[model samples]
Target: MQAYRIVRDDLTQPAVLALLQFHLDEMNRWSPADKVHAMAAERLRAPDVTFFSAWDGAALASVGALRDLGAGRGELKSMRSAPDYRGRGAGRAMLDRLLDEARARGMTWLGLETGRPQAFRDAHALYAANGFAECAPFGDYVSDDFSLCMERGL
Candidate 1:
């Protein structure tokens, strides 16, 4: 695995924007329109969300965000590793950073919504390995065939 430096992102860098666009595109390709829950760059910049990116030197490797859901809860959003960086520890590094931030904010739990297709298997495995378990729908999400919700206690 390559060394990664995970830092808070302003979502203004060209590379960051490109990666996020790619993420949204891929999400649309794999899921129905209504089932696509990936947030755009604008939503990611909301005051309640703190976005972070993992970098390999100057190259963007991955991106993730933690959205304050109030009441000691947080929601992980927009986690994606660049194509070349997948399986290279960048995603895990970003996830670790988000988890740390949630803990620091006194969050009692962290939840996420992801696709349920085979294309999302790796992501599901990563979260499962890190102690996340299948959960009911959270926040504005509703139970659906195309979506999988998972959560882990902080």
Candidate 2:
């Protein structure tokens, strides 16, 4: 139930990779080009990003990351929860932790991209409930029918 940020390392890499794969597979299952799946673990290894992992004592339950875009803006990336842990509030906890991290870093706004498919219904609801309002495309993403973008001011 405790979620926190950590370095990208051997112990955490596998879990992160699994989460990334889950997102990829979900996208492929719908429409391959519809989802913009990014390698979060690799991105976290960059100097301008912060990565977090959630653990339920013995295992990795979820993970999320934030990439600084400078000028007080940040993009949410690589969020995923283990299939066994879904619908148990792990995603919300991960998001709350990431938001706090964003604020601490002097970021005034945070944004994210999620699939617009039925499989992402829960994710869309979670973000909406967490104060993120639908927004136009940010980062390298362009507005598309299959992608939903949202943003929140810290």
Candidate 3:
């Protein structure tokens, strides 16, 4: 069995950087440059963003972040499970960790934006399965058929 666990990450290690790059590259393929909203790995180290990595022993299983959006709101950011680790519960573990952290930090809401293409179908299902329902755009986003915004109260 995989000894997988989630840990607070600083986003500076080579493996973590690779995961962030992978996520960004994938986003670039499916989203227009103008619509890409994922923060760079270095940028995620800013004070407001809490980044986490799911690890299976020494291997990186997945990475995700929670950005403090102020007003007791948080945004789920950069949810990416490494391809090699998909279907092994890494994604779910990372998400649940973020959600638990949000509640622990007193966030009243959590929101996220994801692409509408087939690349994101599994992601949409994961979010919905975890109580995140589709909602109107939040933050600086506008309504977009190519983008799907979802949120849930914390």
Q: Which model scores highest in TM-score?
A: 1
Residue 142, candidate 3: alpha-carbon lDDT: 67
Tens-place lDDT digits, model 2, residues 86-152: 9887888888888888898899999998878787899899999999988999877765778888999
- The TM-score of predicted model 1 comes to 0.97
lDDT of each: 0.93, 0.77, 0.91
Off by over 4 Å in 3: 1-3
The sequence of per-residue lDDT tens digits that candidate 1 reaches over residues 1-154 is 6678888999999999999999999998998988888999999999999999999888899999999999999999999999999988989888989999999999999999998889999999999999999999987787677899999998
- What TM-score, computed on C-alpha atoms, does each candidate reach? 0.97, 0.86, 0.96
Off by over 4 Å in 1: none
Worst 10 residues of 1 by lDDT: 138-147
Alpha carbon lDDT at 123, candidate 3: 96
Which run of 10 residues does model 2 get worst, by summed lDDT? 2-11
Pairs clashing within candidate 1 = none
